[model samples]
Target chain A: GAGVSQSPSNKVTEKGKDVELRCDPISGHTALYWYRQSLGQGLEFLIYFQGNSAPDKSGLPSDRFSAERTGGSVSTLTIQRTQQEDSAVYLCASSRRQGEQPQHFGDGTRLSIL
Target chain B: AQTVTQSQPEMSVQEAETVTLSCTYDTSENNYYLFWYKQPPSRQMILVIRQEAYKQQNATENRFSVNFQKAAKSFSLKISDSQLGDTAMYFCAFMKHAHNDYKLSFGAGTTVTVRA
Candidate 1:
């Protein structure tokens, strides 16, 4: 893809339901990242992948939030037993590589837990 | 943990004029990077500019420039000749230069409304 792509631009799910968000990084990009933007808040880091390996998952909010990347191209974020507090925009970004390279972002998935 | 702060919750600018947004960060790492991102109503984040910590000279991109003060831990963005299209939420971000530390710590963002 020309840029980072995310599926299901908007999602509205009920509490206690599970939701899965997907992200497709740019072609040949080795570094992918996930972030959460709450209402009127800054983006909070969730996780990142470097060549299909997540070295840092410390930012995941809780045990209910989990993510996985496959073939180093696509990543999925899964939230189990979603809470109303989980309502926010889920953003995904990809860079040519880590370090000083700037990451390109997707339009993001607005997940609303009602 | 690195923290970025944008105290201004909202700002108004006249078209064809200039507006400056303030940002400050706390970090102990010597090598790092600073960035400014813009999010419009479309909800897509676009990189406006970036500055490396080691660079003494600030970074500039056309009408967008940054005043980066490493000692003060301040990185301010100056949008010259603001346009109506520039109305958006602007965010300041920080990233450490260490390996596998690709996560960006972002500020609360300043919403800029460019009025004609």
Candidate 2:
């Protein structure tokens, strides 16, 4: 696509329900990243994927939060048993290669756990 | 662990005026990158400007420029001739230059409002 694309721009899910967020990175980009932005807070890194390498999941807040990138192009972030505290905006970004390159971001999915 | 800090939670400026947003980061790595991102009500984060740690000259993009003090670990953004379109939440971010490190550590963000 022309830029990074994210699905379900807004989601309102009940507590304990699972939600899936999708991201389609820019065409030919080799790096993808997931971040979470809470109300009035900074963006927290969730995960990173580079090419075919093993994803860096150290930033995931909990085991309930998981992400997977398929074919190094599209990615999905799954939240299991979502809690009210999980209400926030999930952002996805992609860079040309990785190092020294600026990341392009998608509009983001605003997940509201009610 | 690297950390970015933006002390100002909110700032206001009149249209066509200038405003400076403060940012400071703590990083042990010698080579890294600093960035400023703008998020409007639309929820999209747009990159405003960035500075390479090794460069002595600051980065600039038209009305947006940065004052990067590597020694002080400070990277402040200066918006000249602020427009209503510039009213947004501005974030400061830090990233190491290592080949395997690509995650961006962001500050709490500063909300800028340009009034008429």
Candidate 3:
């Protein structure tokens, strides 16, 4: 992909339902990250995957939020039993490596929990 | 943990003029990286400029530039010859230089609107 790609650009579901967002990082990018942007707020880091290493899950807000990257490329973020507060934009970014490399981002998926 | 702050919530600029957005961060780490990102209504995060803590000189990219002060913990972005396309939300971000620390801490963002 020329840039990071996210699917289902918009999602609307009822509370208590589970939702999954997908991300396809730029080709050859070894580092992938997921973030959440609430209404009128800055992006909050959720998870980071660097190559084959165990993902850095320190930023996950709660147990309901989980993410996994398969084959070190495509990543999926799943929210279990979504709450009204879960309504926000889920963003995905990828960098050539990690460290000082600037991450490229996708347009993001806007999740609305009604 | 690092924290970035953008005191201004909104700003207005005239096209062809220049505008500056303020940002400050709190960090104890000496080695780190700072960045300015622009997100328009389209919601794509675009990197405008980046400054390394180790570099005393600021970073500039065409019409976008940053005034990075290490001691003051401030990284302000300046847009020269602003264009209508520059009307967007600007974010300030900080990242640690450590190999294991790749996540970025971002500010609340400042919304900039350009007037014709």
Candidate 4:
């Protein structure tokens, strides 16, 4: 595809329910990133993947947040037992060749946990 | 840890005027990247400009330019000839020099209002 693509433009789930957000990065991009943005807050880094290896998961707030990238092309961010505070926009971005280039972003998925 | 800071919470500029947005970052690494991104009502974020830490000369993209003071750890963006379309939330971000683990640390965004 020409640009990064994300699924579920908007997702609304119950507080205890689980949800998964998906990201399909630009073809040939090896570095993928996931970020969370709350209302009136900065973009918070969540996870990063380079090729098939993920070296950083320090930004994930708690055990409930997890992300995986398979085949080096698609990634998924899963939230277990979602909390009301989890409501925010989840953004996906990809960089070429291990952060040698600028990151291109996708239209994020806005998740609302009621 | 790398951290970006944008002190001004909100700013307004008249159309056709020039405005400067301030940003400061802290990092021990010598090689890194600084960026300015704009997000309007639409959810997508657009890159405005970038500055490579090695380059002393600031980067310019059309009406957008940056004043990068590496010693001061400041990367401020200057928008020349502001237009109504420039109104958006501006975010300053930083990335380290590490490979396979480059994560962006962003500052609280600044709301820019371009007035007619």
**Candidate fnat values, all:** 0.90, 0.93, 0.88, 0.85
The residue-by-residue lDDT of candidate 2 on B13-40, one tens digit each, is 9999999999999989999999999999
lDDT of 3 by residue, B15-99 (tens): 9999999999999999999999999998989988899999999999999998988889999999999999999999999999887
User: Scoring each candidate complex against the real one, what DockQ results?
Assistant: 0.89, 0.90, 0.91, 0.82
Candidate 4 whole-model C-alpha lDDT, 0 to 1: 0.92
Residue B22 shift from truth in candidate 3, angstroms:
0.4
DockQ of candidate 2 against the true complex: 0.90
Model 1 vs. true fold: TM:
0.98
Which lDDT tens digits does candidate 4 get at residues B1-116? Answer: 88899999999999999999999999899999999999998878889998889999999999999999999999999999999999999999998877555788899999999999
Q: Model 4 fnat? A: 0.85
Distance from true position, residue B101, model 3, in Å?
A: 0.7
- Candidate 3's C-alpha runs over 4 A off are none
What tens digits encode model 4's per-residue C-alpha lDDT throughout A85-112?
9999999999887776578899999999
lDDT of 3 by residue, A10-112 (tens): 9999999999999999999999999999999999999999999999999999999999999999999999999999999999999988774679999999999
Compose the digit string of candidate 1's lDDT tens values, residues A2-107. Answer: 8899999999999999999999999998889999999999899999888846458989999999999988889999999999999999999999887646789999
Candidate 4 Cα errors over 4 Å, as ranges: none
What clash pairs does model 1 have? Answer: none
Quote each prediction's TM-score. 0.98, 0.98, 0.99, 0.96
Error of 4 at B31 (Å): 1.6
